[model samples]
Target: MTSGAPSDWYRWIPEQISARDYELLPEDFCRTIEVVDGHIVKCESPSRLHNRVARRIATHMEAGRKPEPCLMVDTDVDVRISDVPLSLRRPDVIVYRCLDDDAKLYAGDTVLVVEVVSPDSSFHTDTVEKKAAYAAAGIPVYLIVFLTEAADGIELIEEYRLSEGRYHLVCLHTRRLTVDSPIPVDIAFGDLASG
Candidate 1:
């Protein structure tokens, strides 16, 4: 009937909403939501500073890499994992291999997903649950850049790499540091912490 399925059309009305029913979102909606296991989770909105940092990261990655073969979508891009039928999640940024003549709705084989952690997102969901979920989906790198200005001042940069079905903390940089990775890049801690 609308962007969502017939069931999700009425917000206040009581009806069973499944994953399949959750994908029917209005095309013009400004915000993007992730339907995980029938629960609607709002994605973290990018602050101006967050957007700046994200843009820098994507730009650097794109410029430095030769034959750049990945698609970088902003926070509004959705990546659906087949694990749950109705689960449609929009990462702050996602990088996936450029498919040849593949015009699929969702890019599930995303190699990297970056989340600029925000106050609106559930800590456990982003730092823990989503970590595991990405690993299960074969997402190689899950980068988290913290914006909270503490003693480190955006120094808490986490690089979790998936290996053998588990995500192990590979590097935790508390200062402006370079990460030697399959992605290959340096992150300015100040850029992330700055207003």
Candidate 2:
């Protein structure tokens, strides 16, 4: 019996997929796509600046976080928002509860989700669509970081908290970000862009 090459195993994916189907996809393939409303959406590679900002933010958050809740901070991780229609989003940086076993991270487990605005990102998609989705999923906090015009650094960080089943702007930090919700966070904006 002759076995086919690994490439031969590749098959055309359907336009829509369930959460279970998504879970079955190869880990490499899953890194390049996100599921929205049961549909497959390819994710564009983020710019270096975008990645840097996210990493820096996650590092700072991890340092400032309280140890009582035993939260875990991560970058570029899938967050399951819904199961019925299967919606998932990969947040640039996420603060979630530490789990005992290796398992999927759901929206309910998320304490805060951060999205860094990339040069190619659509304003509506980040500010409107994702904002609404995270709020609907009952995520406690959402942070949107806007890059500078030159695309070299962070310009503003808008923190939104869920209230009355909706997100209300809590603060817009331009220089340094300081917040005490879900956990205490204090990060100097300059440090985020600096080498």
Candidate 3:
């Protein structure tokens, strides 16, 4: 195996960056990186199918969302988990409260977070690491979308709810996703697939 230090712009990156300082980074540069414990972690570009599923889910959630809570659905946005050590994650889809100003979103503002499992994604990171982090951040709901064996579309969705400072498996939806907490949402897996 060939091994060498990262070259070019990567070499110039500092060992760690605070959440506040991370915001000062170039928008384009910040788009492809996530901060974990103040360290920069490069994010891989997800497949088109992954993006499509996330977008469809977001669309469905927005359409069925209730008006009372005043929530917003967005895709690929950073949710700051902590600032002291600077832990942040860019979830595939996020449901957050409507903010007055266009500022950074904190975990407290988040209602639900979704992560679509791509062929190249690490199962442990999606199911364990991110789940634990989101729970610790006090996000109420977490969804993990599993792709079909053929990688053509969504196959299953595991919904978890935070209880007593930890997430518990609340529901599993294979054909149709329906959830009541955080907001009522109903989305068919078939609709999330590309034609």
Order of candidates by TM-score, top first? Answer: 2, 3, 1
Clashing pairs for model 1 are: 3-24, 3-25, 3-26, 4-24, 19-86
- Residue-level lDDT of model 1, residues 1-114, one tens digit each, is 454345555463224345445535454341546666556665555677667666666665654554655554444466776534455566666777665434543545677787
Per-residue CA lDDT of model 3 for 48-149, tens digit only, reads 788888898888888878887899899998899999899999999999999865787999999999999875665778998899999999999999999875
TM-score of 1: 0.77
Model 3 alpha-carbon drift over 4 Å, by segment: 1-12, 150-152
The numbered model that scores best in lDDT is 3
Error of 3 at 24 (Å): 2.9
Instruction: Count clashing residue pairs per candidate.
Output: 5, 0, 0
lDDT of each: 0.63, 0.84, 0.84
Tens digits of per-residue lDDT, candidate 2, 118-164, equal 74664667899899999999999999998886433778889999999
TM-score per candidate, chains pooled:
0.77, 0.91, 0.90
Using TM-score as the yardstick, the better of models 1 and 2 is 2
Specify the highest-TM-score model's number. Answer: 2
Prediction RMSDs, each to the true structure? 3.7, 3.2, 5.3
Q: Which ten residues in a row have the lowest lDDT in candidate 2?
A: 1-10
